[model samples]
Target: MDRNFARALSLVLKSEGGWSDNPADPGGATMKGVTLANFRRYVKADATKAELRRISDDQVAMVYRRFYWDAVAGALLPDGIDYAVFDFAVNSGPGRAAKYLQAVLGVVQDGRIGPATLAAAGAKPAGVVIDALCDARLAFLEKLPTWPSFGRGWSARVASVRRQALLISAAPLTTTVSVPSAPASADAVAPTAPPAGAGPHTGAEAPAAPPESVSPAKAAGILALIALALGALTAWAAHLPCNLLGVFCQ
Candidate 1:
């Protein structure tokens, strides 16, 4: 395994959390985000619930590699993009995650990573590809029936993953051209001293993020509304409080 890929998988595991048996969770009896069914399928072990609970860290890693990382060809992707795609697969599925990457790259979204998708990814800068993928991910998640139930956490995860992917993409191999540092404001000045024990001050922040493309955001909003409309058809589902959904309630 590539060291960068190993590192990426480590971060994904951290984000996926540990065992969960929430009643609302579709993936029943997941340990470290590997569903029980998937665990059995990948490990070829007809392990009982108790045995699954005792699954080793090595087992979990292997399962992730087989089902998610390797399935998405994580080793072939650029640094930040690799982790973003891998994590999306873990949360969503490998097929959907692959489709999201394809959508971002303007490739045929057949939900399979083919030669064309790989070629497009190879040609694009990692930062650009990662940002677009995360945007697409958030859009797709907003369309899920579970969004009202899990949107807040899901949105936060997307945001965090996007930032991390950008950081990783910027780390090595690329020149300053990926993102040029903005010039300091002509009127900018060092801050005055703080209170006695306030400690040292920090420097200028990064330039504001470029304005978002309108189409994805608009499409995502429409899809989220469609999902919300359909959610009303279910007796078990209700409009979650906007705060819980990570939206402005008022």
Candidate 2:
């Protein structure tokens, strides 16, 4: 197992708790965070509800690893980043988790974690990425039909995930466990503060982020497209057959 895998899973389990068969929950039944359907697919093809309830630690670990961790390519991701994406994957689907990760990185949202996505992620500070991703997660969860029923626990989980992810990102990892989180309300949400032991906020604040990188290829392609459009317009205005850019000027 990767070093961070165990740490991340441990934190997630706290929010999952024992056995839950809440009818309102679409997951139906979950044990140690693994839904029965997933358990059946992974551990036992014909697994019964009884088997899911009796799911062991080892089985839980396997399901998480194959379905969640590997799906997000967690091993290649940075410390806290891996946990953030991993938790989101467990709660949401891995594809959505990957897309969320991509969205925050400002890369193409292809719903797959690959080299381009990793490059974009590594360019930004992990803390910033985690905060952005958590904010996006909360925004999305609030839109769900079930939000009225389960929003509180989801909020709490997001808040806890954001804080703990930041902790592990900065080197010397904390042994302290994290609870689920977000905010009870806009007025009630406590802002995430700097980690302990950092002295008062002195000195000038960091400068604004630099501009997006220039893409010569994209620029060239766009310029070519513009030229084609211009040519098509000229052809149309002149009442000639339109051939430029496949723009039909009948």
Candidate 3:
């Protein structure tokens, strides 16, 4: 019901930390969880591993906010569910993440997070959705050929994501419409899924989807630091004081 991009992104970055270029990784090489392709499209066309390794936090945040977070409609989604889906989108491909989320919601398995999906997701409690979505995500990952190498790490990540997502759902979330994975499996031909939050693009999802529209809430909390920079992307009314969930705290 509100925008939680900053908070959500912060949590995700905790998991994405640093750079890695496992040759077994289908996404090739990545920096701060971004694939070489995404870096090329967003920051540099001729971006090299060296440049990717040194990607600034600002750039990393920009890519995740516009691509991964927004693609999963993080701003519109409930707190915990928003994080769960965003992390899922980052770890697996956004298309597959959206479909799994829809599966939990019993909505059509279209790989997009449109109004219908929003409404369905909103109707359910964020905690329940987080649990179901995480379970489903693990189930899918467990069956992958790479599970032997990444399964334990993936399970740990999903557990942590579930735990944190539930915490967000429990707390009143307030960051509202903000920006916006990785993967392979039985659906190898389906969409790309980064090995456990490894990347954020896959499947039929466009490299970038327009950030979902969201209603503005009073900019509460101290983290409105980027309110100005975000501009039209996700501006909170700084004058009014509200909690992270956009509700008056006391």
By lDDT, who's the top model here? 2
Q: Each candidate: how many clashes?
A: 0, 10, 32
lDDT of 1 by residue, 55-114 (tens): 888888899888888888888777788888988999999999998899889999998776
Which TM-score value belongs to model 3? 0.67
* Tens-digit lDDT string for candidate 3 (124-233): 98888899999999999999999998889889999999998888887756546465345545445534444775655555554555597654553443336566557644
Question: How does candidate 3 score on lDDT?
Answer: 0.84
Q: Which regions of candidate 3 deviate over 4 angstroms? A: 173-250
Candidate 2 lDDT over 38-94, as tens digits, reads 998999999988989999999999999999999999998988999999999999999
Which window of 10 residues has the lowest lDDT sum in candidate 1?
A: 234-243
Cα distance off (Å), candidate 1, residue 77: 1.1
Span of ten consecutive residues with least summed lDDT in model 3: 214-223
List CA RMSD, all candidates: 37.9, 33.2, 36.4
RMSD of 1: 37.9
lDDT of 2 at 7: 95
Off by over 4 Å in 2: 172-250
